[model samples]
Target: MKTKIFGHRGSAGTHPENTMISFKEAARVGADGIELDIQMTKDGVIVVIHDETVKRTTNGKDKGWVKDYTLKQLKKMDASYKFKDQYGICEIPTLEEVFDWAKSNQLLINVEFKTGLVAYKGIEEKTLKMINDYGLEDRIVLSSFNHYSLVKCRQLSSTIDLAILYMEGLYEPWDYAKRLHTNGIHPYHQTINKEIVDESIRNGIAVRPFTINDEKKMKEFIDYGCSAIITDHPKMAAALIK
Candidate 1:
């Protein structure tokens, strides 16, 4: 089980998360794939920002970013504007834009579904449609902690691979993925160990851990037979691992 470099939120260590610029840098570093989170906006538009309340990720003018506003409103807020003095003002991009860039650049993408309490209103359907629309069944990996979202995706897209993202101390999760017909398991960085990873591998399930930036930690993931390792610094990890 050789580990490949999966960029977390598109080289977020270098730039803001879920942006075209960040993803481009990640591709420049030769990441095997880039990971991003998705949340739908008020007008039922599926955008690529992570938080349910967009206050943290975007520089919004009013109450919340995505909860009350549509993609048009989201476009006005500069997600990286606050960091302009530091990293410069970069605006938030939609999922369509992200996928377009990734597909054109021949990059693999891991899109995480985050629906907040409201469940992003048909994001799974939209995502499945996008996968088909972009003809990215082979290049994109759809993942989510929400089993319902993943299940919907599996039902919707026959070819687009699905990964069930879980955190530490999860009990008997493989049974769930099997039921959902998922292709892989994506776990948090700290919780994965040699035993679980090997078990997953033995079952013919692909195992990938998320957001691992530590070189030694990544070495351990490789030692555990993880299929892939998602990282904030794919450039650094790719350099060190080679």
Candidate 2:
């Protein structure tokens, strides 16, 4: 089977990470899926951003926690100004906006919940409901480093696809996936190997390794038959695969 290429943070290497412009660039480059991060604002609106704080990606410094800012406050900051002016004042998009784009474009989205550090109390339910409202249950994959969050997501919606994200090597990852009732495992690129990829495939679990920017590593994972490779340079990976 051909390996899928998922744009990491919506082609983060070329565009401002997690912005709508970045996601549009990923789609333009022909990526199979787009990976993004979701976190709740103080008003409980889900916003697409990778970091808990907006300091690094936005014009503002020391903006405190993402959850502390209301959507109106968060939207005031320019998400793409730090990267380049060509991106043209990209705003941190709401999950609903992204869901609308994804549904219209028929693109697969891997929504990584930024719950590893702060457990946003009803994020799972809110996220799931949004996905359902958009009729995108088949196209969305909910993934997170916090396994407990994935479990909660599963408890809320059994049909939603869940992937466990971990940075360490796992033993019999497929068994662990079975226990969690997840459909996939997302490992840090450095932790994935041929054996684990093969085992995951054998057990019918998707193995997608993340943040691979190097062409050599991308080729290696493709050779290992990963279900997908999540990378900052989706165009490079797509060219190499072709």
Candidate 3:
């Protein structure tokens, strides 16, 4: 199988990370999929963002925890704060908005639950319902650093895909993944090697390393026969794959 390229936070190297524009750019560049993070708002609405605190991504005016703001309040801040001079203001996108938009394209969506820190009550159930409502189970992959959250998601839906996200080296992670009922692993790019990739693939587990932006490293992973690579520059990776 051809190694797939998934846009990390939607072509984060070029566009404002996690915004709709970033996602659209990734699709336009022929990325096989897009990876994004999700956190619940103060009003319990699921939104696409990477940080627990809004101070880093959003305009400084709204500086606080994401859980402190309602969806409406979050929409008011500019998520494109870092690139304001270039892209202007971009609102934080809701999961519903992303799902609705995703229907227009044939892009696989990797939704990473931001539950490693603040465990949003009932987030797994709520997110699963939204995915079902959008009828996107086949195209979606749910991943997280929290193994407990992954287990919860598996319990809620037997058919949906689950991937474990980890940063450290593991002794035969495929075995651990099997025990957790997860079929995929998204490891920190630096933590994966040829043996790990080969073993995981042999065991029918997908191996996709995250945030790989270096050209040489991208080529190395592709050569290792990884199922996919999550990268910040989808355009560059697509060019390489071609």
Candidate 4:
């Protein structure tokens, strides 16, 4: 079977990362799903963004004030973040805003709990509630490098498809999944090879790679039967998949 394609931060290659504009663009280009990162704000609101700091994605003067600011304050900050001169005015999007966008579409959503100066506790429950509010229990997947978050989601909703995200070789993911009872593993794209890929397939564990943009490298993983790829360049991936 062909692998499913998810837009990393909503095809971040086209628009600024984590904005609804980017998600809209990804869906416009036929992405099967969107990969989103979640973080809790200072006011206990769940917002969609990638980095621990807002400075990277927003034109914030300070680096660590993302959560210190309210959701409205976050929206007021310009999200036209430029690293290499590519400009896009993307505002911060709330979890509800994203779910509203996904409600009537065929777009599957993967919400990654990204914690770094903030505790990810209760984020899983909040995310699950948001998904349920939209009646998208079957159309969304929740993943996290924090095994506890994924486990908590399972505790809250067993029927929810869970995926473990790992950056390093901390443990045998297949064994971890078996112990944790997760259905999928979403690992950093560069960490995979033929051996591990084959092993995942043999073990009946779904493997999806992250942030892959190189065409040649993408084909190699697809040839190895990858379950999916969370990518920055969905158009490139679409062409490669074709």
**Candidates arranged by lDDT, highest first:** 3, 2, 4, 1
Backbone clashes per model, in order?
A: 0, 0, 0, 0
lDDT of each: 0.80, 0.91, 0.94, 0.81
lDDT of 4 by residue, 1-242 (tens): 78888999998987888888789888888788899988877777899888877877777777665667778778777776663266546678889999887766889898888864567567777888878888998888788887887777888887888888988763567778868878888998877787777787678788988878888877888888888888898877877777
* lDDT, candidate 1, at 135: 84
**Cand. 3 Cα-lDDT:** 0.94
Which one wins on TM-score? 3
Give the TM-scores of the predictions, in the order they appear.
Answer: 0.93, 0.97, 0.98, 0.92
lDDT of 2 by residue, 1-242 (tens): 99998999998999999999899899999898899999999999999999998888887566789999999999988899457666678899999999878866977899999998888989999999999988999999999999999999888987899999999888898889989999999999888779989989899899999989998898899999999999999999989889
All predictions: root-mean-square deviation over Cα? Answer: 1.7, 1.1, 0.8, 2.0
Best by lDDT: 3
Candidate 1 collision pairs: none
Q: If both were scored by lDDT, which would come out higher, candidate 1 or candidate 3?
A: 3
Compose the digit string of candidate 3's lDDT tens values, residues 33-118: 99999999999999999999999998847489998899988888899956778898898999999999999988999999999999
Please give the range of 10 consecutive residues that has the lowest summed lDDT in model 4: 80-89
**Candidate 2 CA-lDDT value:** 0.91
In terms of TM-score, how similar is model 4 to the real structure? 0.92
Task: List runs of model 2 lying over 4 Å from the truth.
Answer: none
